[model samples]
Target: MHIPRWAIPAAVVAASGMLLTGCGKVPPGQQANVGVGAPQAVPDPARQDPSAAPSQSAAPTVLRVAEAARLGKVVTDAEGRTLYRFDKDTARPPASTCLDSCANTWPPVTAPKGRIQVDGVDRNLIGKTKRPDGLWQVTLGGWPLYRYAEDDGPGDVKGQGVGGSWFAAAPDGKKAGGEQQEQDDGDGNGGGRNRWAGWTVVKVRQHPRLGMIVTDGEGRVMYRFDGDRPRVSNCDGQCAKTWPIVKFTNWKKLKTEGVERSRIGFIERKDGSCQLTINGRPMYYFAGDRRPGDANGQGARNAWWVVSPRGEKITG
Candidate 1:
């Protein structure tokens, strides 16, 4: 898939353990980049660089962050796997480099063309895109849907904050470009200066099913996956037969209790119709996500991970 310069900063607390969508959101202004010091890249585990601390340099003019804890939610697959969020993201770029043979390592969430519910999230701004293969891809507010190839096994977060251009999607599930969260007053360990380094702007999103899933007593989405990261996506044309798009014709018609207005949104496609993009990525009914809460796609790739609304992993 192609990466779009304008991506979603959707921080997710995935209820499932799988990291497919587990692979995670948005482009914030360049000023508040995650690291104040130079960002070093290390591919192999042996070469993993130690995480750098934020410098006490001048703060960025605008610091985009996840919504406060109160407004956040969480998601989990049926089997009780945990999820987390990626702290980084880039501008709107729709092309995803993980495809073809690489896609075997990470499967894309697939769904057919349709209309999306636009009850709360700015539905008017939702849009869609068409790939070179003529396949219609959904866009939230404009951010395209994609899967991460590096995410192996369910709940693996290898894709978290890659290139500082990507991030783990939030529970809200919609790719929204709303205002950034305000900085906390208590920043410094001592007296006056704000501990800008410790404060992180969790990129988040709002998907259609985030807060709408059938939950357990403790409110966990159940996820079950039989593979690991770097594994091949077993579902293909025919394999995808069982898992379909959980589509709805009109947002005005459905009646969901306790669901937030901002949590719901729409995505438009090339067919002139619209679909749903959770938090900002496209939503797909996993062919194997059977039994209403099953997350069969977790761990297919190492980059996949889930998140909570408050920016934590979704656990029982």
Candidate 2:
């Protein structure tokens, strides 16, 4: 239940690749009391398509279940655009942590001032909470709903696991992806979050901008700090807040692809937590890198550099 030091809300996510498929049924015994709301036209200025104008009609905001490639039954808006929930947000009290700039990227699915239509989703689980801006945002199973701005149209779920927090919403207001439910592994990270079977724990990706960069399990590019000696990490405190260390507890759980298994190791931090390392260099996740394929931490301050599959620093 603890939020990380560098925790940001959400962003566009790459699709999770796995062969698993099945219909996700809502768990039983979950019931809440809330009034129905009629849908109205809510403007989303951050929409990717500038040519797509806002709807002027008074149609109800339709919430329904749809099938995703690997994520199975997921919640989508009337446009078929995938809706997501933030892991940092709370469902027990029906609160949202995504705000300001985060809200700009992941727009809250604002329920119209009046009744919403539902399919597959339990209407009893549907409700609304007043955002700080005084807008009535839609909520499901007490968890607020949101839409990824980068998701172009129907069937586009480009925001599946950004920042290790964002995920496609299931009909029952739980994290979607069929049988792959979020389970805590005692690290407070909810186990391999959004990671599916055959997903690599460490791998080499041919980044279009950085080329042949090392990526963590979720495909977020990893970095190495020049300030640290081999097997030691100097990036802690506020430095760690900006570049969170790659943490792991079990060695057997670390999987790799295109990277040598011998190169993968770990170092105990001053905090008593084990941080994943590659070829003796400590690994990190840049807080600025919102999603997979992002190498925003590359050449940062001329000290931080993205690592390559060979466990060498990537200069370009």
Candidate 3:
């Protein structure tokens, strides 16, 4: 029998773990870009970095509703720049904690006249709060709004997970982006009673070096093997032992955003196991990875690597 290029011979499987040990180590500078669940660095607006502060433009008096490809419905300024909410801010009391440098980097959405106009949003939820700078900032559903300086134009979400504290604001004053809990359906399929249901099977994970990559429901990084074609499982026996297949119980219930549904399907392994495929390539998890967001398997032996939402391999 001819083994696929991705499949390792049984002899190599016995020592694969030892040979692949410590292969996941990313360089110091490269690791700095990986952002897991939240952002670690608090953005300092006072640093005076031109890129860190919004341009000097007229304050937007009207807020509008815009659709983000991955974030659904989000609130934007008159110019269409995405507005964000700080995780540290309290909604009940309606306060603005972003001051000085923080304010420079994320300029508060000021409503100078205390009266603001809104489009496609509930007018009742629109309100105003006093900032430390003595400016009246706009508030939606009791949450203050701000624009990210890093965003060059409208619809930029560069601050979405910055410092793990900032996120795009929803029309209802909720965080526009982040992971949600997956509910288990009685069937083996992972679906909850909520609207998320099948859509929760796949999600986005931010890596310091890899930007945004696709992850399974448990947040484990998903990988694609180069040797296999679409709907084919070339990794078997010892090969499968090192890189286990990623399988889903119900294909119809598998929901995904930012990914093409036509590229998703399954393949039968030699051992009679069903493995998941994206864009005709089989997906798997590294046996060496023990926790969520682990991409230790990336660049392994110049063959394994994590995949982007668009089904491209993240080699770097």
Candidate 4:
């Protein structure tokens, strides 16, 4: 862990106002457009007009739990927003490939006649799943659950992993942040082994149109290098083979939250190893962004982008 550059832009503006609360302050590169196309049915303030009264027909579909300091509890809705899951969608028999405009940008969390309302969750892992317009939706362990129309408030997880197959939603149904989990070892023969242990060596991941940035520990996407400076690192060799460098063997078990353990530092490259770094720039990873949220190198030629934990950059 090295971080320096005067503590990388006020610890990325105090971890981007603590992982983007309400997310409306927009600035460095604009924000709020997230993930781009396909998902546009907006309008459902819990479906207005039930005679339009009791606070517009009582808009509280209930199903709570929220704490997200890098994603802990999560799973919200009785007006608390944040709820997602859809790695192409499928949970045993529960399915929902995010239809029509991706179900108008991930809406389906309906309870309809199922009349939902659970607090700390676990009503036998909450169930329900039929959407194809048949409504129903809301399922917990069997997956199916949604929200994120670019999430505006209520503990806003900004839809956590967005296009990397969305995430955020764990009250046992799994996927509330931390990410990278593979571990199978039981001899089932799937041969697993990718684990960041307790995870979070750096957080914030979302990009419907690039609303949140900074990733790592398997969620990938992390760049920055306006031609380098502070701790210096002008690419190197074929630009470090398309842009690899983002190392950190242990760094004392690094496990950043919103980011800012003094901005976290470590440079020393030229091949002698030791790369990482945030406020002092020098972070990379874009061999064309093979998977995990892929930023494709954000703005690339204009000098790369995607940093923001308040360290700015982001580009668009």
Measured by TM-score, the strongest candidate is 3
RMSD of 2: 19.6
Better of 2 and 3 by lDDT: 2
1-316 per-residue lDDT for model 3 (tens digits): 9764224443453344212111122222211111110011333444345554333245788899999869889999889999998754545446676766677788999876546888998999888887646677788887789999899997788888897568888887777854332232111132343443333255555677898787775667889988776555577779888998787444434654335444455544444445566765778999999887789999998989899866789888
Candidate 1 residues 1-316, lDDT tens each? 8632113121221222212110112111101101010011223332132222111121111111233223232221222121222111111323222223333333323324445333333445444444323344433323333445565544544554454333333334332222132221111122343322322112223224443232211222322222211111222355335433223233333222122222333333322233332333323344454442444544334422243332222332
Best by lDDT: 2
Ten-residue stretch with the least lDDT total in model 4 = 31-40
Among all windows of 10 consecutive residues in model 1, the one with the lowest summed lDDT is 30-39
Q: After superposition, how far is residue 314 of candidate 3 from its true place, in Å?
A: 1.4
Ranking by lDDT: 2, 3, 4, 1
Model 4, span 142-253: residue lDDT tens: 7888887888888878778876668988898878867763321111111254335532256555567987677774668888888887556778889888998877443444
lDDT of 1 at 44: 30
- Return model 4's CA RMSD, one decimal: 17.9
TM-score of 4: 0.27
- How many residue-pair clashes does candidate 1 contain? 109
Clashes of each: 109, 7, 9, 15
Q: Local error of candidate 4 at 49, Å?
A: 21
Question: In angstroms, how far off is 88's CA in candidate 1?
Answer: 12
Question: Worst lDDT window (10 residues) for model 3?
Answer: 31-40
Cα distance off (Å), candidate 3, residue 163: 34
After aligning candidate 4 to the native by TM-score, how far in Å is the CA of 196 from where it should be?
13
Error of 3 at 61 (Å): 12
Each prediction's whole-model lDDT (CA): 0.29, 0.67, 0.66, 0.63
